[model samples]
Target chain A: MNKMQQRLLHPSKATRQDRFGKTISLICIGFIMILTVSIIGFIAIHGLATFFENHVSVMQFIFSSNWNPGQLGKNGQPQVGAFAMIVASFAVTLLAAILATPFAIAVALYMTELAPKRGAKMLQPVIELLVGIPSVVYGFIGLVVIVPAIRSVFGGTGFGILAGSIVLFVMILPTITSLTIDSLQQVPDHYRKASLALGATKWQTIYKVILRAALPGILTAIVFGMARAFGEALAVQMVIGNAALTPTSLTSPTATLTSQLTSQMGDTIMGTLPNNALWSLALVLLIMSVIFNLLIKVVGKRGEMKK
Target chain B: MTTNETVITTKDVRLYYGEHEALHGINLDFQKSQITALIGPSGCGKSTYLRCLNRMNDLIHDVTITGSFKIDGHDIYRPQQDVVSLRKKVGMVFQQPNPFPFSVYDNVAYGLRVQGIKDKKIISQKVEESLKQAAVWDEVKDDLTKNALSFSGGQQQRICIARLLAVKPDVILLDEPTSALDPISSAKIEEMLLQIKDQYTIIIVTHSMQQASRISDKTAFMLNGDLVEYGDTKKIFLNPEQEATSDYLNGKFG
Candidate 1:
């Protein structure tokens, strides 16, 4: 009777606990929303301020390659076109994605599908170790080793789009590979069995069935890799020569939006037109990454739908 | 049923997953153009036996199988045997309806394409014929472009059969093909199997005793990694020579 009577007292306690849980979760979600909204809102306002303060046309900023920020006597008229930076950023990111995707897929398939249990266990930690190594270390390696190798091979200053692409490729390899492994591992074993039962070879089963089934996940991985490549500043800036010009060849030096903003942020005075332009660049970078993130969601959601 | 020719014969077959032996010296034979239903309790090696027909069990790690599995006098388990070609002769359908997440046409065309049959007309004709043979052609012919996964469970299972049939395998192994389906779908599959048994050797692993009695010409009862009984389905169901087989059929104990 005592235990039963005590059980009667549990409803209110459970309700209170439920309320607390709900409140905490709501607060956490609200906090994230507020932070993201404030950050994007601030960037948008400052980015548009460049056009508002200096009579700089948005079209010119996006299209014109000339980017000489005027000082004294030129007043607010700053040559702030970032078209070259946009092209360079895209070229570097695309090149990195192209370089990393096939290797990532191959490594992922070998690790998750083909490797023995013990070998895979040993290799997994090594791959994760690669991921844990700071991006700056990769940058250092690129500047020291990759740049020189490029110079010896391709015969150029070597601190160019290709160097940046290689460094970004190495930096994003672990990210893409791990994500691909995760996606490949998620496919049910039944898919492989079905394909193999149809007399398809193991490799055929992997590429035709397993890879097709895991496509959306792999796409999400590549998008994440590309986003990282696009948003990367420190590593790419260090290896790239940071010349504010469009790259005509792989060996030609070019500056990405990230590189330009990172380089000029400290040089510009507070509330100056150049400072607003930098903010505008930051906004562009943010927009690019957010678009990729959205693409990830779209791809993941489609995968879930298929499942 | 026809000429008493053994399409599949296994001699002193033993399968081990690492240290544990799952099949203990299994010796079984199946006839050409007949249905052989494998009946057993769970984990009794019936599914494992079915998989051994196409060497599907080879996909698992730490599986050490010492056995001579021969199909039509060709040693299937021999190292020299090409698994791809062997599987082309022995297709398999899993317990669940595992249609690839493509259109119905593409799902049926998968095996042919894997064999490098690239002519669009050949693929289209084979896909249509296989779908018709699987008895789902009328329902899906209007929507060959529709996603295979969008079909009902039973229809998806039939599509998988069509996929296997597209390659024209000599033997089709079905592992509990109708277990996940409704009774009507199960009946449809049973009827379809009965019709197709004239052309292809059928090996099915089933949990249902009634299904075994209804569809199979020969039934093999496996009990704890051993072949407890293997005989004509009627005799095995009604007057089994083994006590364990009768006990299981009588629902006394598994």
Candidate 2:
């Protein structure tokens, strides 16, 4: 058909709807992109000078892990060391994630598959309530309860990386369990039924088919959980004892970048250096979180595409 | 015909999904070494009846079935009955191609593996024999290691058949196995069904009147969850005893 005839036959209303939908969606996406760029620009503008300053070497900052630097020469003042803080942060986060994973999966499984209707109805609200509780309360509990318990067992030093990890583990449990339950629930009912119908036992059906199919989603949940654990701040500070020295064990006094930044921000001598370091630490933390989230999304999307 | 050779029989069976009754006290006999086709419209309970033969309907929550369903002269609905063995003896193929996401050989070997038959030689032999019986060995033999989902729609359906056959079930239940396939695929499935009828009792539920006439030795016409007529396939197709059955066969109504 000729162009004019085709235009008349097709009608402009359909094309107009498609164009309008595209324009509206583009506007929404553009708004979010602009907001992100603006925030990143602000952080980079304030912190770009630190990257160039000879006062702090990049290798010394990352590799040596000695965070404290002097306003004068090495002979004039003692430099604050950060090796302990970095190691303590990673050690505590790893411990928390490992301790919480199995319990989270069991809670998720019970919530999704085995719990009775009334029990699920009651447990769901309680689990969701855990999410809304303020982080400070969990920290307070760690101070009053977990610290003392550890002290009683490990000679009464109530503050350390272990205490901080226990607190953070409790704080992030709800997030991991809820995400796991969502992933398990999304597995197709037919896969379960088909497995069961093939004369496989109930546990076999879940392990061989349900869990196999839901692996990507479960892995995503774990990565997100680890990301949350590594970035937690106020709660970690309260239980970690905030010592500037490196911790040799879970019970040893130490500090995280967050706690160090908070403590040093108040000192008059530390000034903008501590604040600048905090921003840099935040950039590192942000990059790590994004990497993990991207990993989860990529794996989950691949699984969905295969299906 | 020997009465002792029957594969599956139901006596005044009643099935209810919640308060609503689906099957209204139906009695039927599924014979050995023959093809029995149940033809009816959607929601006429044909598929439900087929699931009942293998006790698959028991999986539905809040469903209650009364009366006796027996296979090899044993009551399948008995409280003490072992559903695992029952399912192994009476395998089912679904309306859609529901092949497991695995290699073609693995799909065929799924049943054997579930039964704890771990010998590598036995599994390989059974997988090949089952694929051959389903008439898909030659087409898939070269690519047995490839994912079953890579196959065409017809080939996937046949792979499902091969999977079920590897279980060595005495009775095979098919629910509109070819309704999802094209005409050529449907014809291939019909021919394969005819070839395998001698080794196993085959009960197929179909919507197509022509398929029922072509492949079935015995045909049962059903409407609204009740059997209207049942007899030899040739007699039912050409001269049905009931007016409703004839009307359905003649394309007057379904």
Point out where model 1 deviates above 4 Å.
A1-11, A72-76, A116-119
Native contacts recovered by model 2? 0.31
| Position B226, candidate 2: lDDT | 83
DockQ-based CAPRI category assigned to the predicted complex of candidate 2: acceptable
Model 2 agreement with the true structure over A148-214: per-residue lDDT tens digits? 9988998648789899989888877888888888888988776666665566666766776667777
Q: Model 2 scores what on Cα lDDT?
A: 0.80
Count the clashes in each prediction: 0, 3
lDDT of 2 by residue, B137-199 (tens): 999999999888789999998998998888888999999999999999899999999998888
For residues B1-254, write the lDDT of model 1, one tens digit per residue. Answer: 34767888998888999999999999999997789999988989999988888988887778888888889999998779998999999999999999887889988999999999999999999999999999999999999999899999999999999999999999999999999999999999999999999888899999998999999999999999999889999999989999999999998876
Clashing pairs for predicted structure model 2, backbone only = A67-A82, A68-A80, A84-A246
Weakest ten-residue segment in model 1 chain B by summed lDDT:
B1-10
lDDT (C-alpha) at residue A201 in model 1: 90
**Full-model lDDT for every candidate:** 0.90, 0.80
